[model samples]
Target: MKRIVFSAMAACMIVSACATAQDGTGLSKKEKKAGWKQLFDGKTLTGWHQFHAKPGSTPAWKAVDGTLFLDTDAKASGASGGDLVTNEDYENFEFEYEWKISPNGNSGVMFGVNEDKKYGATYSTGPEMQVIDDAGHPDGKNKKHNSGELYDMIAAPKFYAKPVGEWNKAKIIKKDGKITLFLNGEKTAETTMGTPEWQELLNNSKFKTWKGFGEYPKGKIALQDHGDKVWYRNLKIRQL
Candidate 1:
């Protein structure tokens, strides 16, 4: 009788906990139980660093009001900070984050980014999930360059994107060489890497000129600084 009562009480507590998860904050208990780790603590850039900022200089990125933002106007002064990258490398994983771009802003979230002196830019290596103002940015003119698309490689099927300054959720799932992209609760793109289909896409795109662009089976994730103001938060990753 005591064991039955204890079990009932635990179930009730679990239900209550799931109802109160605060979005854009730290990971929930359920997420932690499922092996999810917080990439952004909502206050600092602890696990990330400037991708190519000059030695011993601070990146032109800021964390404010629980959001990480890049100042595009400041970056235009030639004090460029480049992109931001995770300190750890991941091979197959699920990554989710929320972002909002200013009017006419342009940015991207990249994975499979390799850090080598030979690579002049992060997009040269990693595949980018383009982030831009769907209606305001010039890239928005092209379906393939809009938010949640695979940046000139694959167009996101569902073109549902919120307006500027409104937060939008995006997800990237890569496991066993199959990659999937999600934007605002909709599946945007899906593809498999290293296959002939992928090869053809690579051949058609400009990335073919760059060696080993998306061939890496493992690499760091990156947030782009495309000389545009952008805000990001609620970064969470779970290894699959």
Candidate 2:
């Protein structure tokens, strides 16, 4: 009987391990083998901070229920809710995250963001992967500004974002000057940086006059506050 009980306990342990491996906030065995690292840790804001915040300022973003979410109420109450940026800069990497936006909300995930006092906003230096409620937000009417597009540079061929309140999977991969964006398992946009074509697109976009927009080869990743409610989870990255 003792032997049988020991075997059952071991089985339970195995099941628990498997369940943990499949947790949304954790890396799977395969993901670990492939060198994926969890960025958010599903608990605390350990490796992130507000963009251009003074030293020791508390971030207005919250981590609860395995989500990193912007506290819009705090912003509405006049709290300093700036864009959140990764503590570490990444170059030539793949980043994936899940996001859920409120009705008529707006937000974005930006890469190559230069955190400098000279640049007043995160979008000033980094290009954005647009995030919004496609069915509710005014920006949704412009395909270039819809969720998953490369901000105003390239438009998604078709709407690929889920409705408001539903989580959508988003991925950005940048390698060797080429970047690709994916939303809900569909490729939304792709562009090669530093090319004449890229320069032409930039010249035609709103960022044309912005001195350093989309010019960084290595910079921090940012999550825009946009004065809107948004939640993000499962943020992971793999360096290329």
Top-scoring candidate (lDDT): 2
* CA RMSD of all predictions: 3.6, 4.2
Clashes of each: 0, 0
lDDT of 1 by residue, 49-168 (tens): 888656777677878898888976665575557899999999899999999998999999999988887888888889999899988888799858989988888987668689888999
Model 1 residue 226 CA deviation (Å) reads: 0.5
**TM-scores, one per candidate:** 0.89, 0.89
Model 2: lowest-lDDT 10 consecutive positions: 16-25
lDDT of 2 by residue, 44-95 (tens): 9999989988876666799989999998887656567899999999989999
Worst 10 residues of 1 by lDDT: 19-28
lDDT of 1 at 5: 100
Model 2 regions lying over 4 Å from their true place:
1-20, 23-25, 76-78
How does model 2 fare in lDDT?
A: 0.91
